[model samples]
Target: MILDIYKDALEYSAKDWKTLVILGVMCLFSFLLLPVFLITGYNYRVINTAVHGIINGRDPLPDFEDLIDMFVDGVKVVIVQVMYLIVPVIVFVIFAIVAGHFNGGLSTALMIIGGLITFILIIVACLMSQMGLCHMAYNDGAFSKAFALSEIKEVIEEIGWSECLMTYLGLVIITVVIASVVSIIIGAIFTVFGISGFALGVNASGVFLLGAFINSIVSMFIVGPYLSIFNARSMGLLYTMQI
Candidate 1:
């Protein structure tokens, strides 16, 4: 399944090289409003595609068709994520205000408690959000489906909670490793060749700034989408197990 996840994303991107590059370029310039929309739209499409792939027993990184649908689904997903995270955000905000307003033993205690609670809530939210998104996908992008706790729990039970959690953690670790390696390689290349050899000769500050810029390009153009596809494929596989 892991190999399939990697192969699916790799083959899909290879086949859609032109489209992927175009999207990557768009993401490169995503400081503009339109590009931001398209980039996010693409992300939502990934989730949608994962949903379809899971249901169909094949991991397909969807194409860049159905722009309006992708955009709308993407917006809905963002909303779903935000809504799931609202409680944690509120808790942190309140604790932050409290910690700021009052500085004492009581304040210190509150801060510690808040920190622990916030951390727990964040973990729960992450797990819940993934299941919720899968539920939403299963239900044809119906936002309300994400909140169907009983049904979601049943699906989780079918998959086995421990198994699901381990799979998720493993996937997270894999992605982090991939991203770290990509960053290290890109940084080394630019720092050694571009910065040390050229940019630093011109301007030290510019060298660092240029490294950051190039890093963003490599991240968006290659690493980011690759990880996104990999994630979607893995999640789809998880969902498939339940079915």
Candidate 2:
């Protein structure tokens, strides 16, 4: 089922090159803040379309439209995410602050325990945030529905917790592998070019800097949006499974 979801997601996202490029450009300027939210809103749209398509037997990719609404929805998505993350973040910060006051093995052990707890909390937060966003989409973008804990739990239970965990873990591993490979390839290409220039008496620093700049651009404009859409589509498909 996970494999099928990814297969379809890749095909679905790549079908429209124009839309993909538009998304990539938005991702490139995402540091401006507005574009990032618009992208988030688009992801919400994808989830909505995916759910409807599952029921209607045809899920199509959504187009960019209604900027105001997309921005608003994106803000809602951010709020839902921030709310879900607040507890873990607070716990981690407070624990670190308190632990710093002690100077001994006990402090080190406490810090380790704090790190472990914080890690667990972050994982849980991410799981809940994804499910919450899907729920909000399914509920027709009702902001409150995203926080419906009981319904969220029922949704997870229906999907089977173990399967969902493995599915998400698969997604994470795939994403990390792709990122790592891209970084290595970029670094290697840049190093080769830098070495060649250095041997010719050209400054290696400039070559390395140019490589870093290009890699950053590629990551922000291409890799980031592509992965975002893939994950969004996968989540949309995952939500559709409950139907």
Best by lDDT: 2
| lDDT for each residue of candidate 2 in 124-216, tens digit (9 for 90 to 100) | 788888888898889888899899989988888898887677777777887888777897899899999999989999889888988898888
Clashes of 1: 0
What are the root-mean-square deviations of the candidates from the true structure over C-alphas? Answer: 3.7, 2.4
Judge candidate 1 at residue 23 and give its lDDT.
74
Which residue pairs collide in model 1, if any?
none
Query: lDDT of model 1 at residue 156?
Result: 81
What is model 2's C-alpha RMSD? 2.4
Q: Per-residue lDDT of 161-219 in model 1, one digit per residue for the tens? A: 88777767777787899878888886786677655656446555655667778787777
Q: List residue ranges in candidate 2 displaced over 4 A.
A: 55-58, 199-206
Which residue pairs collide in model 2, if any? none
* Poorest 10 consecutive residues by lDDT, candidate 1: 52-61
